[model samples]
Target chain A: MEEEVVSEENVTPVDEAEGADQEVEVTEEDARLAEIAELNNRLLRVQADYDNFRRRSREEKEAAAKYRSQNVIEALLPVIDNFERALLVKPEAEEAKSLLQGMEMVYRQFQDTLKSEGVEVIETVGQPFDPHLHQAVMQVEEEGFESNQIVEELQKGYKLKDRVLRPSMVKVNA
Target chain B: MEEEVVSEENVTPVDEAEGADQEVEVTEEDARLAEIAELNNRLLRVQADYDNFRRRSREEKEAAAKYRSQNVIEALLPVIDNFERALLVKPEAEEAKSLLQGMEMVYRQFQDTLKSEGVEVIETVGQPFDPHLHQAVMQVEEEGFESNQIVEELQKGYKLKDRVLRPSMVKVNA
Candidate 1:
């Protein structure tokens, strides 16, 4: 800010010297016209810069929103590994019943976290299949389900808000 | 852009009308000074706006970088829940053996996902305890380990590129 004031002062002395000399030949209207033109040019440049800045910032904000969960997902991977280890061990003794209970609690916590962030499972079975949410893997003649209805889910599908993250793999009733 | 041009023309006509009438009463020098003052005022306002725009854009960029991982974290919570579900079920028979193996495979995939994103575990036991990476839950006297060295990790800690998301809970040798 101080530097701006200093530069302004530097410009003033030279302008005054020019004015004293030019005042003889140059009319006041001509001088005002020149000053207005210069000011208008500067104004246009600054306005252009402001517009570009606003556009770039908006793009950056969108990218940030799109990828916000990358780190947290990475951190929770080990929690999944721990769950697999506990499951593979096959809780042999009655004493280790608490181990299973603890895992269930953690699992619930994980689900709650996802739900709070608008991540949800795509409903497949018994519902009318939509290509946006479900991918048909096979067609089966199921007795109870209607035609074009999903009879079985081969792999789970997930969505983040309205956007499908992974389409549900399913078998459609013939 | 057309609106801007029209507005500029409107301003010019009014200024010219006023100048023609005031020309007899106001000296040419006074008119030049007034025009210079108006131009100076506009130039100052534009420069101030440019400064503010630059500062605002920089803050937006910082905010975007901070929240980049939020969505990915939300998406993986369900995967963690699936691991917990697989672990909770007691594998009572040989039929469940393949189920356990499938869970293990998913768990490995989760680990690989995290590793690809630069997430890593903070090593605690046998290493010198640093408050930045390890949160000491207890202190114990140990024969082999040096003072302030971690003896056991109660819960693992994780880091995402030098930034600790969760500190390791551990016991340090007194």
Candidate 2:
């Protein structure tokens, strides 16, 4: 009887071990699938981030192009003031007159440089008024002029390439 | 004898299944480890990309600041030419004389605008020669001047803030 009892305990444990082994097999397969899913999710996130990075780079380049000349122009504003001041001088002698002539040469050189760089004056007079290029401060009914036509420009506007740097201030025919 | 043979076949298949299950378990564990490693690698690559993006943005901003007024300054060159042309006129009448005065006024206005924008003329005469700011075109011996002192400025040089827009051309005292 004791020998039978000892044998029975040994067999029972063997059966339990087999059941546990099978359970481990199933769990192992599930774990592998979960790992694959997690990896795929990470790959997707990285790809998305790469796409955003490319878009931002393109935008930065465009912005850089649009405003590339802002500082240089700002610096030249004082030079413009100097030109105006030179023009205001009333020459009393021949030497002063010659100096004025030299100033004119410098002024022409400055203007030619600006033209070569794609700066254009906005034309407002005798054209149909559009809000994008012109700011209308006054309106009047004028004979032989179409309604909404710009009658005169109070201040000149300028454009660089296709972009308006300053809007024209104008009088429109009502 | 037939019953013993049939029982042996059944036992053989059970042993084979256990061996196959163990093999599958080992391979699954290895695959799990590989997946984790791949995910970690991807995470690292994304982080590196982000770092690069930030660096590029900083570079772009610096470039923009450096060249912001390039276009505007280029455009204004034409206006300078016009000023020069006006100065060349030897006005024979009062009307022409007043126009010259007007031109002088404009020139002064232009210079003041440039001064307000951080544009400065490089001083060369009697100053010690520095290669970064002055381009030496000639060397001459002059009384009461130190060696390497700038004797004259052949052409004006300008700086916008800390950056030199143009280097001064100079004659240095040998």
Candidate 3:
């Protein structure tokens, strides 16, 4: 009787083990799926980060190509000013006068080229003055103009692709 | 007999159903894990793309800022040429000479300012001919100089931060 009972308990447990192993595979599968889900989330984030990096690099290269001439252009402004002033002078000699005219033509052509390349002169004289790209050198009272109106342009301002390279010096009317 | 068989099948089927349910659950769990893994992969790729975009924008912004003034400087080359020519000329009247002198001073100051901002003049006269920054308009046979030497700089070249704005027009000697 004692042996039979022991055998019964052992056999029952063995039988139950095989059945449970076959049935409970669902829980093991669930655990594996959970692990895979976690891994998948991590991989997705890493790939996204890599994409962002590639996009950023392409944009950077384009920007490098776009603004390659800024410093040189700024340096040339004074030369333009000189040419303009030179043209304004009325030279006595025909040769000097012709030279001045030629210089003026060249200056205009140069201005046109720069305009084509996105360099622009800021018009401030006789316009409502703003501190953003115009510097006030002196203020005076004017009968017809509103306060803070630019009466005279002391110096011209310039912009390179919407960025102010230099501020225009101006006299404002109050 | 028919009732007995039906009852036996029912009794046997309970165990079978439990085992099948568990096995099916495991398969479902695996499928879920696979789905999660796929999602994670997509997420990672998208995230990487975003990161690349961000990086490119940043680089582009930097490059734009770096090369913004090239056009303006190129436009002003003729004006600079005019000033340099004026400096070479001897004025007749005292007032006229003084005015030219003042203009010269201003031009020098302007050039100095440009130098401070990274504008450089390409020195070519008396130097060996370099096609990189010098354009040979005419070649002259000379006794004192070797072949391919620059004798005179017709038009000066200017550079900003290692970029050539214009090639200098030069007289090459053979």
The model with the greatest lDDT is 3
- Candidate 3 lDDT tens digits, B48-135: 6666767767776665665555555556566667657756756566545655665566568667867776679999978999888899
Error of 2 at A42 (Å): 2.9
lDDT of 1 by residue, B90-154 (tens): 66544454445555565666666766666677899899999999999999999999999999998
By the DockQ metric, which is better: model 1 or model 3? 1
In what order do the candidates fall by DockQ, top score first?
2, 1, 3
In candidate 1, residue B121 scores what lDDT? Answer: 72
Write down the C-alpha DockQ for each prediction: 0.18, 0.24, 0.17
Looking at model 2, residue B157 earns an lDDT score of 69
Better of 1 and 3 by lDDT: 3
Segments in model 3 whose C-alpha atoms lie over 4 Å from true places: A1-27, A35-141, A146-174, B1-66
Q: How well does candidate 2 score on lDDT at residue B19?
A: 53
Ordered from best to worst lDDT, the candidate numbers read 3, 2, 1
Model 3, range A1-174, lDDT digits (tens) per residue? Answer: 011111122123446765664444445555666667677767766766666666766676666556555666676677778757755677676555544555455556768877877788899867899898899999999788888889889888998787888999999997
Candidate 1 C-alpha lDDT tens digits along A1-174: 000001121223345775464343234445455676787787788778878877887887776676466355435535544554545555544434444555456556666776666667789999999999999999999898998999998777777666676788999998
Candidate closest to the true structure, highest TM-score: 2
- Give the root-mean-square deviation of each candidate in angstroms: 10.9, 9.7, 10.1
How high is the lDDT of residue A163 in model 2? 73
Per-candidate TM-score against the hidden true structure:
0.61, 0.74, 0.61
Docking class of 1: incorrect
